[model samples]
Target: MTRNVGGIDRAARIVAGAALILLALTGAIGAWGWIGVLLLATGLLSVCPAYLPFGFSTCKAK
Candidate 1:
């Protein structure tokens, strides 16, 4: 898959994902926080399926 996520976006996703997961593990948030896994996965993979529908991409044009 093409990388539609850029550096900043990836970093933000990783941070938010980690925070949500931590909160969920600590029982600070609802189980829904587990959805953070999707963020983490997208960030690491640099591919956002949601962006494809809109033809959006954060990566710099090569």
Candidate 2:
């Protein structure tokens, strides 16, 4: 799949993901913590399935 994440979008996702995981590990969040894992995955992969259906693309494809 093409990269649909970039710039601050990607950066924010990564940071948020990390924060969520840390918080979850500390028992700050429950099942919702899994959302962070998903974010981490999407950020690392540079692809967001949600963006596809909405025709959203943050990265300018090479």
lDDT against the true structure, per candidate, is: 0.94, 0.88
lDDT of 1: 0.94
Model 2 Cα lDDT, one tens digit per residue, 1-62: 98899978888999899889888888888767768888888888999999999989999767
The global Cα lDDT (0 to 1) of model 2 is 0.88
Best by lDDT: 1
Q: List the residue pairs that clash in candidate 1.
A: none
Q: List candidate 1 stretches off by more than 4 Å.
A: none
* Candidate 2, superposed: residue stretches over 4 Å from native: none
Error of 1 at 1 (Å): 0.7
Model 1 over residues 1-62: C-alpha lDDT tens digits? 88899999999999999999998999999898999999999999999999999999999999
